[model samples]
Target chain A: MAPTPLAVSIAATIASLVLLFGVLELVRRRRLREKYALLWILTAVVLLILSVWRGAVSGIATALGVSYGPTVLFAVGALFILVVLLHYSTVISALTDRTVVLAQKVASLEQRIDELERGQDSES
Target chain B: MAKRCLAIIPAFNEAGAVGDVIRAIQRERPDVDVAVIDDGSRDATAKVAREAGAIVLQLPFNLGIGGAVQTGYKYAWDNGYDIAIQVDADGQHPPSEMSKVIDPVASGEADMVIGTRFREEGGFKSSAVRRIGIAMFAWLVSTIIREKVTDTTSGFRAVNRKGIALFESDYPQDYPEVETQALAHKHGLRLMEVPVQMEERQAGESSIKLWGSFYYVVKVTLALVIGLFRKPIPLPEEGGH
Candidate 1:
């Protein structure tokens, strides 16, 4: 396996570190719920491990007959992105449906309250 | 006790047409209580419906046709309505023909009755393209539900308490008319079609434009097929949310 450039490896490791810390900061600040941050944290940790142990990717790439090591990383990275996006799609669908139900209930209750208030006013 | 009937008129920006639609229902069925679901219209839909002697449930914003209609169902379910008929606010569903749809449900003949424009002729038959689309959708929904549904996309429907409970708890969100029959059938609710004369919409355009017909087909097909796999929700508790 051709050795990855020292500068490139160092930059990747740093970028991965930044991502891990960034997600952690968001979690600490309560900006991201743990349920959602769990996937992000897992992603950052995997990215860091791959960047630091550069040989792991190139070694697998050579076995798979892939010409370049980074190409394999990008391919796997794209698949990871697709899976995350699909998860997001499901979350959004469920949330919107729940929102619709909530809106319906709230509207109904508000009308009921208005009628009750009008009844009280007329009774007095 | 007499069955409590509710005429649910779901309206968007059809202020010009909604008032007359309400009056027509009052004229045809004085015993049935009318409730108009005002789906966040920019005009005076809520005011017009209320002034026309109907209770108006005004949504805070537009919820599309499905959401609006489901809101009406929820209201029917919550208030212990024994029968609910969904008529469009645009006047396409003539309230004059109200009994043709309502009678089946009231008499315990069917859990739900869809008022079809395709049968018994003489009224708006829809455009050439819409007729083809209506046919295809009927085939798809009929095959899936194992029921012969002629006008699968007709929004004009009447539902008994059973059907109302089924939908208020679990209703399709988009292009709901086609999927609702399948949903009701799967839950063991009986569906029947009655021929009724419909009029050209009194105001505003249909939600589905001609250009979006292709997308409508694909989306509705997906919703119908995907729906069959979902587990049926437990029946809603009597007289509760």
Candidate 2:
């Protein structure tokens, strides 16, 4: 037997609520940065809205010429995951670049400090 | 005006060989100042290099070969060095051959001088697989830049003040040795290579292992091809600094 529309909606609603609470709890415990948490919160909110409105998912799927409504939920979930993954990768790339620059700066500063100390020793 | 030359050695976990490399440069080219960029090595690379009388720049974390070398270039540029020579800290590059590579840049005949081991006279030879990969890169680079590039993978190079200024701001951070030549060419820098003797690495395993060589070729080739379509990096405007 196929999963009933009511059961699907309830499952989506529960999943959305779990994600929203999980994200908020992570932010509250300082396990996640506010910037990153914001993205998850937005995702959870959108998923929550689609689950609670019940007809919104079917309406969007029908409008897009998709025959099945549940497929839309799966599609949106997959798209959301892809987007979040891309976002994290971009963030990682940026952090790597900054860390390199920081390392270079720290190294140069240490060298300068050493030179200054040597100069002082010689002068004394 | 006499040229102030700096030998920039980027070392990562090269504690076993870094000190000897620094001392060798001192012994061979006493006129040149030695600066070692310790690329966040967990080993004693910084201490050994400093004890050997070379100035050490201790990076807080590892930035691989490219970032480490770029850091050296930035140091050379900021410190007002007239010529910057790159020497591998693993002892593959002979310190005695530095003047040979540096002479072209010093005389203003070339903005960048690469020390090539692929020449008929150079005694050093890499594994057959590596040589093939190097040849392929050399061919690709030569075709695009319209200049014969013998050793695109050579890390031993000397760059004049102008070249230093260019690399200080923009340098590739991944597998940079081959791509940097193309970058130099794109920015209108004259490039030439001279025959230089090399020895087997004294210590520390090669960064690109046998298994990783395939990945290196693929990744670097893709980067070079992609770079061809990208707009050339603009030179810093004069009097902007």
> Which candidate comes out best when scored by DockQ?
2
TM-score of chain A of 1: 0.89
Q: What is the interface RMSD of each candidate, in Å?
A: 14.4, 15.7
Per residue, candidate 1 scores C-alpha lDDT tens digits across B51-136 of: 99999998877778888899999999989999999999898988888899999999999999999987886777567888898899
Give the residue spans of candidate 2 off by over 4 A. Answer: A1-124, B237-241
Error of 1 at B8 (Å): 0.6
Model 1, stretches more than 4 Å misplaced?
A: A1-124
Candidate 2 clash pair list: none
Q: Which structure among the candidates has the greatest TM-score? A: 1
Tell me the deviation in Å of residue B1 in model 1. Answer: 2.5
lDDT of 2 by residue, B179-237 (tens): 89988888889999898888988898877888877667766775576567556656654
**What pairs collide in candidate 1?**
none
Per-model B-chain TM-score: 0.97, 0.95
Clashes, model 2? 0
